[model samples]
Target: MQGEWTGELVGPDVWVSCRELIPAGSVFAFLAEHRAALSPAETFADMYPSRNGRPSMPPQVMAAAVIL
Candidate 1:
């Protein structure tokens, strides 16, 4: 599988870029901020899958991000 990616700050000058395989230490903020860069299906499945995969975010956290 192939996809687009963009890097963002995890700390001062430290960056994390999500791609076909996300780096293990990437934070939720990085994933959510760059959500649009990935395929819709991949984003949904990875970020909010119906069953086992990566853990889904709480509704409150998702809502907070959407509001920003």
Candidate 2:
């Protein structure tokens, strides 16, 4: 199953914001700014055919991590 990135970007536990630290135009900054639009999890839906297992980490997030 294709999982979604539903975690709050701004939450009570989040003391420091990523947008405040990631350097502009850097690869990390680019991924933080455009991860969802560039790598929608829906595109990898076919990779997980069964719907009875544990929820997978979002593909977009995985892709972003790989890039970083």
TM-score of each: 0.22, 0.63
Question: Who wins the lDDT comparison?
Answer: 2
Clashes of 2: 0
How do the residues 1-68 of candidate 1 rate in per-residue lDDT, one tens digit apiece? 22222333335532234343545556655655554553243444454435545544444334434643
Residue pairs clashing, model 1: none
